[model samples]
Every structure is written in C-alpha cells, then in structure tokens.
Target: MLPTFAADDYIELAADLPATLQAAIERDLGIDPAQYLANAEAARAASDVATALRAQGVDILGTSIDGQDVTYNVADEADAALAEAAGAEVTVGPIELLDSGREVQPAQDHKGGYGYAYQVAEADETGSFPLSRCSVGFSGFDADGNDRYLTAGHCGVDEETGEQFTYPVHHIELSEPIWATEDWANEFPGPELGEFVPGSMHFGEQHDGGLVDITNPDWTGVPQVAGWAGGSGAPDENSVTIRGPIDAVTGAQACKSGATSGWTCGEILVPAQSTPVGAQDVTGFIFNACLLGGDSGGSVVVGNYALGVNSGSTHDGRTECDSWVPATGPDDTTGDFSIGYSLSTGEYNALTLLGSEWELSVAINTPQVTSPEDGGQTGPTPTFTGTVEAARSTHRVEVTVDGEQSYEGTIADDGTFSVAATEALAPGEHTYEVVATYGNHSRSEVASGTFTSTEVQAEALTVESPTNGQTTDNPRPSFTGTGQPGATVTLAVGDEVLGEATVAEDGTWTIAPSADLPVGERFDATVTQAFEGDSQVVTVSDLGITAAPVTITAPEDGSTVAGDVVFSGTAFAGATIGLAIEGVVTESSERVQTAADEWEGELVVGEDGSWTFTPAEELRDGEYTLTATATLDGGDPELTSSEASVSFTVGAEGDDDGGELPDTGSSNVWMIVVGVGLLVAGGVAIAIRARRGGSTA
Candidate 1:
C-alpha cells in the first residue's frame, strides 16, 4: 500500500522530509511519527483506489501510498478499445514500490541495445540539407575521458554533409552523439549494445517509448510511456531495448514494449522459440508477446530486464491474431508466428561489427566556456575564450554564451578559436555552449562560468512612490526606489521596518505598508537614503485643515471669574478654540464669525484656578487656557491665539447659596448655571418688589 492515498497522508509526507527526497524515498523518517503512519495508511487507501481504477481499464500516471507517490498502468480508453476490438481480456497487477538505489551499469547479457542512424545530405540541396527529425546519439563520457557514440554508417560517408549533420537529438534517450568519420558499423565502431539512457528513441514508427537508464546517467528518471507501442517507435534494426533486472523478469508473465500493439503481454509458452524468415533463413526465439506489422525492432522486457527484441510476425487475416500460435497472435485459435532475435546474438554481432579500428571510449569532461572565467578582478571588464577538440579538426565551430550568440568564430588552422567575446560582461554565473560546425555538420557542448567584482560601490537611491510629504488615503503605500537595477532595495516607514524587494532591470518597485499605523490626521513622511545625500523628512499636513488669525472678542485677558466665562475668538470659517487649564484640555467649540474669521465658544472657570477660552466646551479650571485654531477647508492651518491662562476664585461671589452654587463643584457646570441663573433671578425679584412698593405708596 502507498502512504499517500488520502490528502492528509500526502501533506504529512511533504512535511516530513525535503521535497526532492520524497520522490526517492517511500518510507517516512522524521520527528513526526504520525506523519509516517498516516502516509502509510493513505498509501494503502490510494493503492486500493488505483487498483479499482485499473480494474475499470483506466490508466493512471502516478499515485501515492503511505507518504510516497505511486504509479499505476491502468488500461486507458485506447487500450480498452484495442482490447475489445481484439476480443481479449485484461487485468491489473499489484502496486510496485520504488526508491533511490545504488547505480550500476547494464550487464552484457541484457538482451537490448541502442544505435544511431545518421542523416546525410540529399543530393539536390541548396544551403544545407536538414536532418529533419533525425539526429545522433552519444555513449556519453566513460571514466577514461573518452566519449564515443553511434550513427549511421551512411551519415559519415559524405565528406561535406557528414560534418554538418552532426547534431544532438533533443529529448532523445541517449548520450549526446558527435559525428565521427569512422564507421560505427564497421571501420568506426558505434556505441556498445545494451547501453541505457533516460530518454526515448524514435524509429519513425507509430509508437514512441523512452527508456530509462537505471545504472548509467546515474539512474536518470524516465517519463512514463502509457504502454508498449504507446511511447516512441522502435527502430527496424532492433538496436535498442528496455530491460528490467533478472529478478523482475518472469516467464509466462505479461511484458511491455514500444511497438504497434502497446501493452500486449502474452503468456511465455517457451523461453526460446527458433523460427526462420522467408528467403532470409534467420532463425530466432519467439516469445508469448504477440507482434504485429509495426512491432519490429522493439525491446520485450520483464520488469527491468530485457528479454528479446521483436523481429516480425505473420499477419493474421482480417487484422486478427490467429488462435493456433498463442505466443504470436491475439487469439490462440488462429495460426500466428511471434518471433524475435535474442540479445546474445545481437551482442555477438556487435562485437564483430565494432572492430578495433574505431576506438569506443566514454568520459565526462567539462565543456568549454567562451565567456570570461576569472576570479577577484575589478575596474576593467573581462573577456573569455576557449576551444574544443574533435578527431577531425576540419569541422566548423560556433561558440556561444547562454545559448545566445556571443562568438561564432570558426575552428582555425589549429582546430580551435582564439577570439574575444562580443560584449563586456559583468560578474555572475553564465552558461556557455560550444557548437561544432562543418558545412552541414553541427554538435553543441555546454559549460558554465562565474565572474566577480569587489570594487564597484552601490549607487544612490531615489524615491518613486510618494513624493516629499505626500499623503495618501491608502494606509499601505507602495514604496518605490531607483538605484542599481536588479539590486535589493531596503525600505522602512517611521520606526517600523519594512521588507526588502529586488528591483527589476528597470529601477522601479512597489510595496505595501508594514503594519497598522497611527490614526493621526497628519504624519511625518521621512524618506531616507533615497539618494546619494543623507536623509530628509517631510511632514504631510492634515487632509482637511486650514490656518487663520483669530482674536479673543469675549472674556478680557487676565479676567478672573468663579462662574462660566464666554471666551470667543475671530478666525476663518471652520476655525476652533479649546481651553487648556494646567495641562488639562476641554472639548473644542467652533462658531463661524465671518468668511475670514470665526468666534469660539465659552469656557467655565472654577474657584482657585486659572481660566482661558479655547475652541469649545466648558471645563473645570484651577487655571484656564485659550487656544485659537482655524481650519479653512483644505487650507493651511492658523493658530490665531497663543495659550492664555488666568486664575480665579469662586468664594469672591459670597453668594451664601451654600454648596448649591453651580460654581462650587466643577467649573464647567457651575459657570453655566450660576452665571445665567444669578442674572435671571435677580431681574425677576427686582421687578416684583418694584410693583408691590408702587401699589402701597
């Protein structure tokens, strides 16, 4: 059972280990034991699900059990159609586990091999005859520093076209092959048979299958081919094979191959069936796997072992396999012939074909770098140069940095280029490609290099977002700067630190505010290190504030009172004033006096306290302050009156009204009540007494 059947197990697997290791490891090993257990459980469930799907004849790419990814070869719709058309039954197998294992080379006994078919220039051609889909395959570099590969003998025959047509086949499962004049078939030996690569081979057939090199290429991963005959087409030469290890090979077991009838696995009736081709008399062993017209030259393997290469099969009447030859046809009722040549024979043939004339060796060497490769340099920009060697120095050469055109110098009389780079490059890592060219022949090599400079100082910075003291409705403003392109820019607001962002090639950046900010109507926008200069601070004024001059019209200066005192100021519209007493503040009050000025409201004075009128509101006062502030709708602010404080006592009134006197408690309440009540009551009493005295006299 796989570990990651359920979503929970899948997440646990990721949490348990690094992402890269997860693919190579099935067992979870980490601090969280539940994660591993959950992965295992999930894998079981997923395996079950995948089994069900395969039973339904659905093809699955990859699945997970416990905590690892799983792969299932469920019969897809196409497979079902093919099976129904052939009237054959199908079934799925158990989940196979896989992980990282030691790398090893393929044994000579492996019954599969690969070779190259070179593309030669056709006679009637202009500039250069293209290979179209054809290219060369290399054997890669062996431990001995020699690189050998294979190509068609005809490809090297033409003097002009051979060198020009030497190009690597992309996405092909083989080593990069360079063109060699020696005949790989005879005079110039080709790659050894049974070699493996993590790519697929195309033989201009209906199917395309890529084989994975488990031992070589360091056990490179292979992209899943839906089934045999579903991947790349197998060649007619029977040169390539996909083999599972011996333990994986099973007799009478169903196997797969890249051929016409993909995924067709027949019971292995006999290990080796000898048969002969008509007129050719080439007798070979026949396997249980049925073969069709396009199944020629395909590798038939069990698990990871290569058993044999498909040769050909007798055609059944009406596109149906004969039942007589169960090993050769879809039906055992009809007569069919399923035959293939053993790899042993192919290997023997290869040894005889790869004579001593063409030396076959492999090695891994660093490709040449055309760009600069130096360390610890400053001031002057560096230039890079190099050359590559081939058995034949007459081939044309093209050098490039990062795949782009850097230098296209040809191989000189000495078979190498001694030229300068086209541009003055900076310090960093660069990928270089060396392409050999001769008429129509071309092969490319890739290498990398790094440059460094310690003398260059970072340039100054400039603000791009908000200008000096620019207020924005958006609390989070994007801080932008102009400096070294692609350089990391550090930003901050007030005392809080903001994160850094890398500038693009163009000097421009955008960032959100760090966190919640103060609610003040105005703030100081301090942009520092914006330029070569030091730092600068600019204060953003209020968005809705103005300033104007105001005069205190009521409550004369230095006036002492125990009751409410009306202190008014003159200023523009929206002007306001507040009373400040001993650092205590009262609510601001406003009253528009004119278009140019406004009169502020009154303030209350208390006993033994200083009093002054401000914008608005009454307040208790040991001392009072008058502050006149004017706000003219989106205009500059004006402080008309400075802070004014005056002290007064409530006892001077001597009202004898007891504690009921309003001025006795908080000055704010007492001022309004006592100040207004005293005047009203005294006036009413005087009127009543005057009427009574007038009547009696």
Candidate 2:
C-alpha cells in the first residue's frame, strides 16, 4: 500500500531533503512525508468550516475570525478549539464551493491578497464602477467542456445572468480593469446562464461561492496584460491539515486547489456551523489562504487531488480595519485578505447524488513471450512483461512460465504490479498463465499465452552408390559413406519416403533395408539435430545409388593381338568396363553397358604380347586385364571375374615358310610355321612383280 503523509510535518523539512532523493521518492512512492503533513495542516485549517457547513448549509457572514469569514475561518479561536477538541491539530477544508459566475483571471493586488491576487470585472464601460480585489481561485470543467473559473461570492453581480464567473487574464502589463464593457466581457469573462453550472444545487447561496466558465473553447493563448502571468509554486503537501475518518465521513485529510497566482493548501475550517444563505446563516469551513476578490472560484484539493472551490471571505481580527464595512468597499480590504468559504460535504453529496459518475478503472491483457519454438533448432528465448490497472485495493496477480508458476505479486495502493519468470527455458512450446486473485468478492478471469524457446539443429543424411545409373541383384554391395546422424533420413524422390534411418549416436549412420532396395526411383532424407540451445542447424545431401555385378570376356593371355579385336561383357546398365592387353589396356579398348547386363566394343591390339582386358568404360589403352562389375539396387557394386588376356603373333619380314612365327606361346609349332609360310608367300609375290617391271623397263 502507498504510504500516507504524516499529520505533523511541514514545508521546512520537505525542502531540506536533497532534491534528487525527494524526486526519487516522489517518482517511486508518489508522496513525501513533509508534503503530506503540509496538506494535512491545510486540510485541518479548512475542515473547521467543512464540518459545520456539512451539518448546516449557509455561511454566517457576521462571524469573522482574524479577518476570515466567521463560518469557516482557520485562525478563529472557536474553530481551532473545536479542532483540538476533536483530536486533530487542524481542520481539513472541503473547498468544493461552486461559484455562481467567475473566471480565474490574473491576480490584481498580490501584495495585499492572501494565497493569490485577482481583479473583479465592473459592469459600466465608463470605468467608474467599483471593482473588488480577488485572491482565492479554483479550476474545473463546465458543461460545454470549457474550463470553469471560480472565486469569492462577493466578487461581482450577475447572479441573475449566471454564476459569478471570471476570465483568464494572461498579460500583467496593461490596464487595470480588463473586459469592463458587456460586449468585451461577453467574449471571455461571461458564460451561459441557463446551464446553471458551477453552482451546487444543494448549497445555493450558502458558502458565498461562485463559478464562471472561461468562454473560449480553446484557450491556449498567453495570459492577458492584466493577468497573473502564470505564477510559480506548485501545491506543497506539507502545508495542509487533516481531520476526521477520511473513508467513513466523506472527509479526507487534505484537498488541493489552484488560483490565478498559483496552487495552495488549506484545511476545512469548521466541522458544522450555522451560517447565512443570502443573508440567512448556513454552515461551512473558512480556509486560511488569505484570499481577496479574484480567488473566488479557485480550486482546493487534497493529496494531489482536487477538493473544493474558493468562496467569500469576511472582515475579522486583521490589521488596518476600523469597522466591518461591506466586502465590496475598500475599508474591509485593509483588515485581512486570507479567508474564504467552500461547499460542505452535504452540498457535494446532494449535487452528485444519483448522478452518473465515471470511476477510474482499466485492465490490460497479459503479455506473451515470442520467439523460440518448442523442439525447434533456431529461435528466441521464453519471456514476457507489461502492466494492469485495478480500481480497488484488493487485487493480486499470479504469473506462470512454461505452464509452471514463476511469480506472484500484489497491486499497490495505486493499483499497479509486475511479475517475471524464474529460469531460462528450453526450445519448444511453452505456455504462461496469469490469474487475478481475490476473496469472496470474486476473482478476475485467467489469461494465458504460448511461446517457444530457441530452435533445434537440422542435420542431413545421405548415401552414395556404386553404379552411376544401373541396378542389379548383387549382395554384400560396397557403399561410399553415410550422412550426418540425428537427421530424418529417407531414401526417396519427391514426396515418397523410401528407406529411412536415424543418424546413429556417431556422426555417421547407414540404412540397409531388409528387403531389396527399390530400383529406378530416387530417394531423399532429412533429419534435425538439436544443438547450441537448439539454435544452430546443418543439412547434408543423400546421393542416388548405382548398381553392379558384371561379366567380361577377352582373348587368351600372354599373346599378341592385332586389328580390331572385339571384347564383350555384361554389366549393369550405365556401367562401363575396360579391355586391356596384358597388363596395359589396348588403344581404345573401352566398353560400356548400354542396357542392363549387356556390353560390347572393339579394341585394336598389335604385335605378339599379352592384352589384358580391365573393367573400364572410358580410358586409353593400358596394361590391365579386363574385369567386370555390376551395380545393384540402392547403387551398390559387385565385382565380376578377373582380367582376361589375349595374344596374337606377326611374322618377321623375309622369314622362310619353316621359320617359326614369333612365339605367342602357341601350343602347335607347325601351325605357326604354316601361318608364317602364308605371310612369306604374299611378300614374295609382291617382290616378284616389282622385279619383272624393272627388267621390262
């Protein structure tokens, strides 16, 4: 709960504290001890009249106390005695006196007035009429949404025209009486009479109070030449007074009010008094602000809040006064300028009774944390913050994070509170709950929100196969590697999920289906790996499979071959195999399987030597035997037979028929001889023809 001002502290102590400290307290707690004391004192002084007027209804004009109105004078011995008797140092002023007509203009005689100074408007344009000096003032709103200026009851006439109102005089350098003529006065100092605003219905003509609505709808212009020029000094709480049980009696410790000169503090001068209503005695308090003519309708407040309006003052024990002259005459001005009357609680009750009033009440929805998604790899943290307003004092709040209670707090006297979560949350869906607390009266509805913590990591899973574009039935096939683990791994293309695998505990993981892997179709897989508070992610690739298991064939080994020597083999579709002579491949001896399990191609071999055929689809002639391979489904490979070699012999030039052909390790020597004889015969024929031609030439 907010702390209230003490009943005794004063302005001296409040001003003594460091400005920074005082400002900090005011910012945080909204009150100062000394300021509260001053307000209480002011209220005590005002209450003397308040109590009496609340009981009765009019101001007793003849009862003057120290130059203040007798019905509501703070310095009056009777009022002070009554206060002390009632167990308070001062009386709280119920300063809500509605003025009949009066605008809050600039103070006129600051030196001679009480809290402020003001000038009263005269009726005649000749400037020969009597004008009262004003001091007290108050601020309020009128029916037309205009600022209503208030002041003393005796400031002027037009009780028939409307409330005794005044106008805002901004400038302080010009003439004495501003807006003297009716035409000029009608522009500002005048107001509509039919509304009868600023007049308390129940306290008509009781407290000698009056009110006037500032005519301009928008009055942002600077003050007139005769106005107070915006006086300094905000209200000081330490100057007020307190009396009565504030909650029970409709009487608070202190009320606040403002005037043409500045803001001021006062107390209810009386509890209950019998005073005059238009020459008839009614009851009310007399505040101690030492006011004059213009202060008529100035506002009175308590604890930084508005309370009442300033009204009439009386001739009392003040200096320089001979007799009790009428308040309008100059003789009464010399006595004292520090007294005024205000409406009593009864008057305000009667006016406000059964009327539609707007109370201060508002509520804001609880905030929700935004960010990290549950089980997500990348996002923000879980958190939320904001405020709510409750009109009553019994409100409390409950806060939860991730579906768990995190904090609980109570609303202060001003109806404000806050809550925070306890610990950092993980990535994933989280829900918060805020429930209002109360007793039998009924609790407020609960509000909730959902949010996520940081996001999780994403890892990709991939697999590579042997053949580029082939499928086979090979078992125990070889694979290149596995993809990153913890990622959702599927072996398929598009929307299809072929074979699936979760990344193993280690970085590498493999998925081998129990059944034969699908042939022809493509597969893709994905996985999520949470890390770094689930904030980082990575994706890898999965390659399509190539199949294997090929068959290859070649000539005998350790023999030379020439011409276009053809080699054939069966390999997985899109599989390539090489044919080599001896340990080196023949020039252009590469062959590829155009279709599944079928391959054939020709390679030129030369001289008597071994031609090895190796499994290579595209390569230069080299010294390697031909071997075959096939790719099965899911792109795995199976090896075929070892390299097979081919050999062939070429006869030497001019060799006889009996001379053995260059041995290519032939099993039959005679067969080689025959082959050599045929080659020699062909050479001899060509030579013979050439010799005959030369002889003929």
Backbone Cα, N, C clashes tallied per candidate:
92, 210
Candidate 2 lDDT over 195-283, as tens digits, reads: 11333322343444444333444431110111121122232322222111121012223232323333323333433333443333334
TM-score of every prediction relative to native: 0.24, 0.31
Candidate 2: residue 392 lDDT (0-100): 25
Candidate 1 achieves a global lDDT of 0.34
Range of the 10 consecutive residues with the lowest summed lDDT in candidate 1: 684-693
Q: State residue 349's C-alpha deviation in candidate 1, in Å.
A: 24
Query: Residue 655 CA error for candidate 2 (Å)?
Result: 99
- Which number leads on TM-score? 2
Root-mean-square deviation (CA) per prediction: 24.1, 32.1
Q: What's the true lDDT of residue 362 in model 2?
A: 17
Q: Estimate every model's Cα lDDT from 0 to 1.
A: 0.34, 0.34
